[model samples]
Target: MVSDTLKAVMQKEGVVAIVAQGKAFPHVVNTWHSYVSVGNDSFIVPVGGMHGMEEALNHDNRVLVTVGSKEVEGLHGMGTGFLLSGHAKMISDGEEYALMKKNYPWARAIMNITILNAIQTV
Candidate 1:
């Protein structure tokens, strides 16, 4: 489950980095906080041109999502970040996909992530 503090940080303006397991090396992609829709323990990200991420997910769907917010207070400071371990899958159709597409007209698919663990880090 996700904590309220973590959810608050996620809603603020920041960069979200998703690391996917690649064949040679780990492939990383960037999205923004505005591009995500949060659930109780999951995230729905609109996919535009993340071909590399999509390819990597073809082999392994495990991902590490890094998110931060300067507006939120950390353990020792005014900013905070979290490293989220989750399972992801690309969805092209369904209710979630419809919602994403309605907001992001250019989106070709949606990356659905089910969070397994979340750790706060400064």
Candidate 2:
């Protein structure tokens, strides 16, 4: 399960940058908005900016997401969460996009990510 604080951060503006391991080191991709799946699983559906981000997703699927409440004090309130491993795919179909658009009104666009692992930190 995701902490309330983390979820709140995700809902805000700006983008979440995910880092994945590559042949040499790591690659990064930024998403304007993300749809987090329920339960303990670590999955994220990153929405918006699909062009270049798709390339980064291809290199590596593993990702780490950072979200927090700046208002809160200490690292406990501002920490990072890990989505150890997962896959990323472009939501090219119009139907899929439409559904996501309907479901997530706040999101300009959407991507579906299946979580393989989820880790919480304080």
Question: Which prediction has the highest lDDT against the true structure?
Answer: 1
Give candidate 1 regions above 4 Å deviation. Answer: none
What lDDT is reached at residue 81 by model 2?
Answer: 41
Residue-wise lDDT of candidate 2 within 1-122, one digit each (tens)? 44554555555544555665666666676655345543344444536655455566667655565443344333455534433345555565577667666766655554555555444444
Index of the highest-TM-score prediction: 1
Could you tell me every candidate's TM-score relative to the true structure? Answer: 0.97, 0.54
Question: Model 2 Cα displacement at 75 (Å)?
Answer: 6.7
> 25 in model 2: Cα distance from truth in Å?
4.9
Clashes of each: 0, 1
Q: What TM-score quantifies how close candidate 1 is to the native fold?
A: 0.97
Q: What lDDT does the true structure give each of the candidates?
A: 0.93, 0.53
| Model 1 lDDT tens row, 1-122 | 77887888987989999999999999999999989998999999999999999999998999999999989989888989999999999999999799889999999999999999999988
